[model samples]
Target chain A: MEKFRANLMLCAGTGCVASGSAKVHAALRDEIKKRGLEDELKIVLTGCNGYCAEGPVMAVYPDEIFYQKLTVEDVPTLVEEHFLKGRPYQKLMFKEPEKKTAIPLMKDIPFFKHQVLRVLRNKGLIDPEKIEEYIARDGYLAAAKALTEMTSEDIIKVIKDSGVRGRGGAGFPTGMKWEFASKVKSDIKFMLCNGDEGDPGAFMDRSVMEADPHSVIEGMIIGAKAIGAHHGFIYVRAEYPLAVQRLQLAIDQATEAGLLGKNILDTGFDFVLEIYLGAGAFVCGEETALMRSIEGKRGMPRPRPPFPAVKGLWDKPSVLNNVETLAQISPIILNGAGWYRSLGTEKSAGTKVFALTGAISNVGLVEVPMGIPLRTIIYDIGGGPKKGRTFKAVQLGGPSGGCIPESLLDIPVTYEDIQATGAIVGSGGMVVMDDNTCMVGTAKFFLEFTADESCGKCVPCRVGTKILLDILTDITEGKGKESDIETLEDLARDILASSLCGLGQTAPNPILTTIKYFRDEYESHIVHKWCKAGVCRDLTTFWIDEKMCKACGACLRACPSKAIVGEKKVPHKIIQELCVNCRTCYDTCKFNSIRILPAGFEGDPYEFLGIGAAAATTGEKKGDA
Target chain B: MPRLTIEDLKKIKEKHRADFTLREGGYRAKVTVHMGTCGIAAGARNVMTALMDEITKANLTDVIITTSGCAGLCAREPLATVEIMDQPPVKYCDLNDDKMRVIFKEHIMGGTPVEKYGLVVGSETTY
Candidate 1:
């Protein structure tokens, strides 16, 4: 083989590719060739680096320098400065949001430092398209061990001892699931991988499938050996074209290398794997519904009496695992159950990967040991809320999960602890919200998604969610009655109890948790007809607080509707007829002068402008909203 | 291709150990060729290529080859630094492909600094 002095691991994951990593790759190749440094350095396009907020990222090995946000114009200078002169370029390195200095090393960056990469172990370290790179990292060694050295019972025992649960959301013990299927007498058993990650704002499984597809494959290989399964299917959604392509490539590579087909590792263990693309239905993420979908039926759930372990995917005994759960199996087999149990809590004995997004400063994917406090993941790893904003809540587990308030931020993030807060760490999508977000509108946002995605298999989910969405929309549009909150609560509880699958069962979580934590916002919308966050235009009256106004005319320039009437040294006022309620003035005001009042407040605007004075204190003078 | 046995997996791992060492960081010795504009202008690339060829020819996986910026001494172009585990770093200046080959054989392989080509025996101040 050939030897090179250094390796340039450029990120080619979906996020980076969307941010133009392909153009960056071409620029790098051209620059390296132009400088005659092509032979001395090797450029390898790897998977997600996890710092997606800083896309077009690259890590130069041997020196360990990390560069971010590389443009085509930067490629020539970067090649001359770093690649040729061997000096790490500081211009494109990651700079702390507050600090001016740049961080050069990827290990030293806080976002990468605090993460424990188990599921994402091969991410950004190897070329996802190369099986050799995967094997070089001891990728399939566990599959080899499970095939050649361990028996079917032994593999189950090790996984059971490791205490890893289903990372898909339910937190069911993986070993017990495998053991149940192993006990059933079936000549043709199935080992299925749930890659149908349907949660909005969640891409943890997609990253794993795209970055290290072989890890999932190797995990399935071990899982198949454990459960006596001769056939497997990875059911990924059709929306993830990159994940599908990489997974297909990885399967072909593994089969060609003789690690995947028949007689694997010369142990006579045969397992054939294939990919099944889902047509983007949210309910298909449910195991039973996923199995039904694979059987060429409409992806709907049946009540779990047989539980897929007894009857699944053509009615033979089967075992279905999440993409993340399978990615963790190889490491457990190679390093023993004790090693896997060393980092996390006793019950949730492993790390979980979270897709951090929304108003958070660092929008990326992070893997942290289970039981780490929600505060650390938010403040330390996420770098807190975006600048000029204060955190209100973090919506975990996507729409199937609930919003955790600031009061519970200190709680440890185990399966039980998060569940105690009325939130499951369901698929680990943490969307941070700032103070400007209206809680009622946020609840309505999630309700709209669930309402649209309800498969209509059962009456409760189909009818109840639509009713809930209608009530939320009415409240946001200033048509709320005092009794609507109680009605919403009752309907949400009924849907949660009577839903057929995981989708409907957990769809009401956002509404229930938001009402529990931010009921004051809901009441304000219903009775007072005011959205203090200025999100719902029908319930908001924009007013200028003259005491704090700077007369800067910034709002005048920013308002799209030409509603502001003011001159130099004069406080600006909105012409109510022309004001579009766009919240541009509220966001544009530098002096905190713009205040949201009750809808159609005709009383003295200055009366409630004082801090802590309620618009309702103006008494019967309130206009009809 | 034939199906691989357990031995083949181990063999492939060993074959790729040298390539992964650069990324995973477990090497007994490190050789940093100062490839600054001044160094590269004076044949530092030749010195680097020669050192890499020597390591591959000797089938050594424990030695790392890397590059860095200028060493603050442009007069001594084509500078190289050698640091073994738990030992002070040694700098060699004004080198060519032949001289790099000799340095690899005597200093890198033998674990002893070649005093003839040595400039300094310690690193610059960090703080």
Candidate 2:
């Protein structure tokens, strides 16, 4: 093996690649070759480093210096200054939003510090394309241990003791599910891996598959051994071309290395694996629907008196585990169940990977312990909401999940705790929302998704979600009735009660949760005909408060419709008839001078409510008065 | 790549031990080659190249090689520092390729500070 003094682990994950890591990679290679430093300094294109918002990012090992937002133009300065002169380039180092000092090390950055990497242990450290690098990190040792040393009963017992639940949203105990399938006598059992990650704003599974493809493969080998299966299939969505390509490469590498195919590790354990591409249907993420899709049928759920553990994937007893759940299996098998049980709560042991997106400052992937508070993940790890915005709520579990209000921010992230607040810790997609986001519109946005993805397999989820989406649309557009709230609640409950599979059952969670927590926002839209957040255009009317306006002409210049009329030293006025309600003027004003009133309001907003102008723009509900 | 037996897995792990040590970190010693303008002008690049060759030749993965700026001693020209885990750092001054190779053998591999080449025992406080 060739040795280099320093390794530059450059991120080439899908996020960083889209942000132009490829150009930077080419530039680095060209510069390194020109300088004759290729022998001394090696460049390794590793997977996601998780701080994706700062791509294209690179971490220089041995020194452990972290550089973010690299462009090809900056590469010359970086290689010359840091790689040659040994002085780190200050321009690319990560600077905190308010602080002037740049954070140099990856471990010092809060986004990377608070995370505990178990499933992502090899992320950004080893090259995903190289099997040698994976083996160097003790990759297949666990599978070797499981196959050669441990019996099927022993593997099942160790996993049951670990208390790891499925990470595909349902939180079912993986060991119990494996035990069920292992106990049932069958001729040929199938070990299936669910990689059909359909949730919006979620990429945990895609990253795991792309970054550490071998870990997933190694995990499947151990799982196949545990369930006494001889064949397996990994069902990935077609949208993830990079993940699919990398996983296929890994599968081919493992097979050639004799780690995957017949007589693996010379222990006479044989297991074959294949990759099955999903058509990007949202419902295929469900276990039964995924099994049907693998069997080459239209992806829809069937009633489960006979679960997949009994009659799955061609009427054979099979064990289907999520990509994340399978990724964690090898680590538990290698380190023992007690090692896996060290971090999380007794009931929900081990860490979970979350894709932090939406209105947060740090949009990336993170793995936190199971029992940590949501406030830590949001405020500490995610850097809170974007600048100058107050946190309103965080939507968890995609469409099947609910929004958690600020009051429940301190709740521990255990499955039970989050479920008690009407949200499941499903697949760890946390979309942080700010004060500018309207709760009614937020519910409507998720309903639009679930309504489109209800699969039409069951009436309650199909027709009931459509009816709920229509009512939410009405509420956001200022056409809602007094009885509409009750109607939405009653209908959401009916869908929750009589839906088949996990899709329709939890589809109404967003509507139900928003009505439970932000009921005042709902009433303000339905009765007062006002969207204080100014998000619902039909219910929103933007106005300039004459007393607060500075006569700066900032709003006048920003208005696309040329609705604002003002001169030097004169407060601006918005022509109601000419205004487009685009909120451009509201956002452009430096001073807090813009006020939102109910649609078609024709009087002075302060005088109509008999309140001070100062209190009017703070999103207070003055309509009840 | 052929089918790897369990023994082959261990061999591959041993071969890549240094790469992982640089990343995941359990290094026994750290060597910092000063690469300031003055140091580079005074054959510091030769010393650095020598150090890299010796580390690779010896297959010492637990010993990390890094570079730092000038140590504020331009008179010394080329300088290097070796700090084993839990020990005070030792700085060697006025180094060349031959002197660096000797230092790698006696001090880095043998774990003894070469008294003739050594200039300082600990780092100066910046604050």
Considering only chain B, report the TM-score of each candidate against the true chain B. 0.95, 0.95
Q: Provide the TM-score of the second chain in candidate 1.
A: 0.95
**Clash pairs detected, candidate 1:** none
> In candidate 2, what are the lDDT values of residues A1-625, reduced to their tens digit?
2778899999999999999999999999999888789998889999887889999999999888999999999999899998888999999998888897988988899999999999888889999999999999887999989988899999999999999999999999999999999988998999999999988999999999999999999988998898889999999999999999999999999999998879998899999999999999999999888998999998899989698899999989998888899888888988899999999999989999999999999999999999999999999999999887899999999989999999999999999999999988999899999998999999999999999988998989899989999999999998999999999999989999999889888999999899999999999999989898999988988888888899999999989999999999999999989998899998898887998888888655776545565343555435431
Whole-model lDDT, candidate 2?
Answer: 0.91
Off by over 4 Å in 2: A607-625
List, residue by residue over A474-536, the lDDT tens digit for candidate 1: 999999999998999999999999988888889999999999999999999999899989999
Question: Pick by TM-score: which candidate is best?
Answer: 2
| Residue A251 miss distance in model 1 (angstroms) | 0.9
Question: Where's the lowest-lDDT run of ten residues in candidate 1 chain A?
Answer: A606-615
TM-score of each: 0.97, 0.98
The digit string of per-residue lDDT tens for model 1 on B1-127 reads 4566778778878888877888888889999999888998999988998988898889888898888988989999889999999899999998999999999999898988999999999988898
